[model samples]
Target chain A: MPDSAFAEIRNLDLFAQMTDENFAALMRGAYVQNFPAQIDLISEGDPSDFLHVVLSGSVDLFSTWNGRDTSLATVRPIATFILAATVKDAPYLMSARTLEKSRIALIPSQDVRAIFDVDGNFARAVVTELAQSYRTVVKSQKDLKLRTSLERLANYVLRQQKRSGEVSSFFLECEKRRLASVLGMTPENLSRAFKGLVPYGVQVEGTRVTILDQGELERFAKPNPLIDDTSV
Target chain B: MPDSAFAEIRNLDLFAQMTDENFAALMRGAYVQNFPAQIDLISEGDPSDFLHVVLSGSVDLFSTWNGRDTSLATVRPIATFILAATVKDAPYLMSARTLEKSRIALIPSQDVRAIFDVDGNFARAVVTELAQSYRTVVKSQKDLKLRTSLERLANYVLRQQKRSGEVSSFFLECEKRRLASVLGMTPENLSRAFKGLVPYGVQVEGTRVTILDQGELERFAKPNPLIDDTSV
Candidate 1:
């Protein structure tokens, strides 16, 4: 494998256990592509032929309903997307688009399958990654189904704080509009939710948010392992 | 394996790959426990020490948020819960409680791990079962995030109709209250939604639901694979 491609594979948890030779064989026919900002990398309902690894920039995953689209998640650099579908040979569940100018590695699903079968380590790594992804989605489901819109935003802020290791402040990773959709709410409702959190010690300024009181926010959000990051 | 246990294992997809001798060894240290209705069998956040197989009756898997609990799903006879957590040695995300008088098989996680390392067929079967369980949870997440309550109920009716076959009316396997929570709606709202669905040609007579018009419900639900099934 090329040094650069090897570095890319190292970043993916699914390829964590791959031997150098196995990794090279797996990527023998794979190639990289650069996508411009806002490019639709993969559309929902399209057949998934490649297992995508985001090499650089970010990918936004969202789904449309009745002409309205909502953000499902943002795939950061060094992670794979639509992997379960790729393994299951199913169509993409949500459309993925580049949030900024990005580069992605495309490995044919057939190669992935072939390599996966021969590499127990690779298969185990895939199992772990897929399980984590599955848990994250389930947590997101619990968030959507169990919490009100305001509660969701409050918890989201604390989760970002935990991710950044800055209890007081963290920059918003995406637009409020997109964030709202990801949280399963309307943009206007998300705006209103921000205002609602003022009493809970949250302050939002443009794309940067500051938490004035962590305890108060936690009291309102009630962060749990299923919803927020304790290990990270 | 005992004759009765052998007959039971035959019905489970997870154990379908096992030969009789292989299965007997796997079950050598396994034990069975019977749970009465409404018993809390497994609590969330506890260590996953054993792999649970529902031998009879049913189980309700759910998570709590802010002192209120939301139903995640139900497990009928012969299904397993927390397999991923068991394999990964992670904390349980959702608690499992008996919904009916039940018989459950518990195999120590250590025993499962031991058998998994030596039995290639069992290892493959375990991975396959974990992958499928993970995908089902992912699909449930899609069900929660990508659809409104009414849409969820509509799609749920279709799913139940499919599960129970083309009968005019079929009894719900679980309680209406738990079903309401699983569908992410209030009992009151579920009641109103049932009334609202009269136009869609679905009728809920007690726990016996009749899909009077499948075409209308399908159109109204707009069931997409990504949102409905097979997306994960």
Candidate 2:
């Protein structure tokens, strides 16, 4: 593995505290691969043989049923996805595809579970990560069930703005179509929702979104910490 | 604490494998209480001070934003709730309430955390339980994002019948209104959906549903194990 790749993953909470010996054991079985954009990284219902760490770029976590697919989440650099399935020896619940040319570290599931058996600190970190992931999905469920497409779009823009250093304008991470899927709306509904937000002061020019009235949008969106606070 | 409660939780995978000594430590700090129906068990944003196990009866895990609320999950007997929060020392993401008079065991979070610190077995168990919880929420998210209310309700009935030992009829777990909330629909919409399913042979009278054409309903719902399998 490249020193940069090793350094990036070693710095993660999931790996930072482990003894160098055990960490070495894991990396010895690990390989870092470069995946091209839009490549299928993993498929839902496949056995989770490896725990993946996206070293750079992004991957979309999505699911499908009855010929319909929707975005479930996106995995960015320096974090792992499907740890729950790896540890539990279960099939992947969602498929992952690279949204852009990306580098990812593949650690064998056996290595992960084996180290977890001997390393209390590693096991502790696994639980912590899983807990955070569970809460995130729970929040998303609340967002989907409690909000309309318009409200969801509004809050999502506000959230992106906050993530981009509380700027007046920022870019959406996903394409509008995938963003619509992530927000549980169709492309047409997303367009209408963008139009629906004009009164509250949101302007969308392609991917660039300028918040003309932050206060008005906040009042309309009401982004609660329990649901919107990523730091939590 | 009652022996029956201890016996019940001991049978759970979360507690089943811990050393007897550690389990004793956990139980010693734990207290079991009977809550009357409709009592609030925990609220969103409240510090997660204790981990709760439902020894009997049921608890609805629900969340609210602005002026509306929806059911996120229901915890039946012989299972735990808010574990992810309790372990992370975070606020409850969803508020919980008794759906009926319930027996619940509350284990101090500190004790749970304390035991987890020293017991590898307990820590491993915690990871497995949290992983399973995460997957369950992921499946629910897929259901919400991918299916219409009518489809959700249809599958819910078929699943319930199967849960009740593949019987021809079964009592709905919650009242129609609460069921609608869980299925992400208004009561009127849920009622209409049930009527919509009448042609497929779903008969709903109060809480009891008789499936006149099981094959037809299954064909309509098209329950995939990836989405509907509780065993996974």
Q: Highest lDDT among the candidates is held by which one?
A: 2
Q: Which ten residues in a row have the lowest lDDT in candidate 2 chain A?
A: A223-232
Candidate 2 C-alpha lDDT tens digits along B52-74: 99988999999999899999899
Best by TM-score: 2
**Per-residue lDDT for B170 in model 2?**
88
Candidate 2 on A1-232: residue-level lDDT in tens?
A: 9998999999999999889999999999999999999999999999999999999999999998899999999999889999999999889999999999999999999999999999988999999999999999999999999998888888899889989999999998789999999999999999999999999999999999999999999999999899899867
- Which stretches of model 2 miss by more than 4 angstroms? none
Residue-level lDDT of model 1, residues A1-232, one tens digit each, is: 3578668677677886678888878788888888999999889888888999988899998777667677878999789998876766777777899999998999998888777767767767776777677677777878887789998898889888878886587899888888988888889999999999999989999988999988898888888886665341
User: How many clashes in candidate 2?
Assistant: 0
DockQ of 1: 0.49
Docking class of 2: high
Q: What's the CA error at residue B111 for candidate 1, in Å?
A: 2.5
